[model samples]
Target chain A: MKAVLPDDLCKIFSKAGSSGSWHKYLKVGDWLVLLLSCALVVSSYTLLWRGGVADRAIVKRDGQTIIEISLNSARKTRVEGPLGTTVIEVQPGRARVFSDPGPRQYCVQQGWLTRAGAVAICAPNHITLELNGRGEASYDSLGY
Target chain B: MTPSGIELPITEDDRRIARYTAAAIALTVAEAALPSPLPGIKPGLANIIVLVVLLRYGWRDAAWVSLLRVVAGSLVIGQLFAPGFFLALAGAVSSLAALFLAVQLPRRWFGAVTISLLAAFAHIGGQLLLARLWLVPHDGVFYLAPLFATAALIFGTINGLIAARLIRQVETI
Candidate 1:
């Protein structure tokens, strides 16, 4: 006795059998897009690396620039935002969100920021800190 | 298998949608359960169902399956109405749009792999845009774009090959 194939499986098999040639599916246009995407990724990273080191850290709260601190100086400041307060610390060419009034404390968990365009954001408190260096800022900021 | 051997009222399209959605949702949940080494990098195995649907059916069916997967997957992962949900929704919308446009290109010129790549890029791009506008609100967010793009390239190709192989297996059956 022949075993009966499931309907869904049968559908896939029959459909695939009747479909057009699979060998010719990829063409020059597809290759072009793939190559361009790869190039874009590579060039963007190269540009990021070339952005050099940052010397300043800018603090912002609720879309407003709060203060700019030189990374050369080690200091700490508190910024108030909608959610609450965030303590920002800058030390020897690097900065970080020392503490924030949030449950997760994500900004604090981001550790340190030393890159030219690295950022630490406390979304709940609407606070953002960005690093700036001697060289030009690379493609905006890294989005997660 | 019904009591009276009677056919179900569901149409073929409906059945296909249900089957593909189930597959995508399973993949999504499994992916979520796994620990990702990086923040935005995942294998995106769910995309295989979308690619297969697009190839066997059409964009309309594929869109339904993809969007349903995002919504249901988010719900399953308990992320509904959260920032993550919104980001996932945005990614789904953009990827579907990308797939729609990619489908317009001649099939011979672009296969599952190319379409997957475009969709993956669009997905990451959408998430980044949403993150900048709402979540982080910093230009620094774009710094992660290259990393996300690299992940997309790798996952997209792998998923595309899996879909292609499945399609070939189905044909052989």
Candidate 2:
């Protein structure tokens, strides 16, 4: 049974019979590439170590001034009203927004913006916060 | 029984095909290892090896080596059925087709690098077409600039030089 596949079709399945061999010459350029890949992987992991998101807040219209609720106050402190209940984890320096009335709920799913310069803004309710620092707590108004 | 029906040459042809196949795999692996900032842009380094094969060896050998490269390289990158793998395969096939045509021209006329550039362009064209059909159909044309400037020229030139050098070595052997 001799079935000759077309050249193009055969090419797609020819891996089993064709692997190239190379001499073991340690080129300086190859070494540089190894170092660079390692550096990129290490830097990304270092940036994520020890800290998840620390805190989150939702600002709702309360007549005059904007009111901020601390997400890390207590696990039991749940907010319920006309606006949907947003369960958040407020850490030392970071705040993770759970839900918001926005076009894309992408920000809410990105649990706990813990890294410095991380932010979640709900423009519909005029709520904003700058997530900063590591797991260290900075003094802010935590109570009504 | 197989597509290359000339019952596996046991002499010089076998040696030639084997050598070309090995070189193609090595180059493909190297290209696959490179960091791709975007989905499509590659230095096109493997084209250099393909160019050498096309110039020194016959088109048949070059075609065989190129085919194996796409298959093996895709598996290594863990992108076997992905769009990127098919893009690369199509590009390689198109590039090889271009190179074969270039080789049919007067050998003394076109340089290896010139042929390489043509091949590189063909590969890019294939990717763009696939992107239009499979990916964002509306904005596929937007992919040309960055791919040409950053990926094509940079890797194509590198591959050209490598091909030029290998041709010299193969001649001596």
Candidate 3:
């Protein structure tokens, strides 16, 4: 066998060819750690997703006056608007709304917004649904 | 027993692989065993070994050890495909790149501690990017905190010191 040179950095490389201690230490970039964190956050979010829709309804007329109602139970809610009442149901996947007072039932078609910055709004009825899964209020009641 | 009272006996090839694998496994165990300040922030003690890997071994070898560490670490932690595992993987990949560059520089130029610190910073940056992509996209910026930054500095320095010490010891041996 050819003698391994002490300064031969390639010796480290060759060691990896089999399976042995070539070096005493190693350094890896933070990228992998960051990726793992992202994965963890996403997984945690998935679990929170199954907690079901956290029912929150906000009613507004002409975008100025507003009244809000929060459902403690996992039940659906219906809010009365100036023109007519709007039925809002909260489910696991998405939040549904029923009312034809506006040009587009934007709120009705708006799918689930699970995380913090997710918001669904209806123009005509002036209603908004904001889902806060990690909210303090939700935790105080029981859990979100 | 091996000469010089060192444990284990092996040929050149065996010694090389063993050291590499030992470093990887040690890092993985450190990662799992050590506690993070927050669930979001970990000390990343493993990166020290990674730095040593990149400097002593070629990038390809370093990559292999990193891959094994992620897979094995995840499996052991049972957090596979979870956010933590991906975060760790990101750090490893970025640090690997940093080390590849560091290795190119003359060994006598920059000390191992300096390289370790750079690798740690790279790991943090990778994590930030991954957060923006997968997790709270808008709030991803929130992931960067002083606590984590401090942890990186402290742990990075520690790893660097350890690497320097190991290098000296290896020379004497």
Please name the candidate that would achieve the greatest DockQ relative to the true structure.
1
lDDT (10s digit) by residue, model 3, range A40-77 = 44654555443444545444455653544454444466
Worst 10 residues of 1 chain B by lDDT: B164-173
Query: In model 2 chain B, which range of ten residues has the least summed lDDT?
Result: B140-149
What is the Cα-based lDDT of residue B173 in candidate 2?
39
* DockQ-better candidate, 1 vs 2: 1
* Residue A118 accuracy (lDDT) in model 2: 59
Give Cα distance to truth, residue A128, candidate 1, Å: 23
Off by over 4 Å in 2: A1-144, B1-11, B140-146
Could you give candidate 2's per-residue lDDT for residues B67-96 as a string of tens digits?
A: 777877778768787887888888888888
Measured by TM-score, how close is model 1 to the native structure? Answer: 0.65
DockQ for every model, please.
Answer: 0.24, 0.02, 0.04
Across A96-123, the per-residue lDDT of candidate 2 in tens digits comes to: 6666665666557677665444555544
Residue A95 shift from truth in candidate 2, angstroms: 35
lDDT of 3 by residue, B16-97 (tens): 6555655566667766777665665666665655556666666776677677777776787788899988987887888888
Model 3 chain A worst lDDT run, 10 consecutive residues: A135-144
lDDT of 2 at A24: 22
List where candidate 3 sits over 4 angstroms from the true fold.
A1-144, B1-15, B143-145
**Candidate 1 residue lDDT tens string, B83-142:** 988988888899999999988888766777888898999999999999899998866677
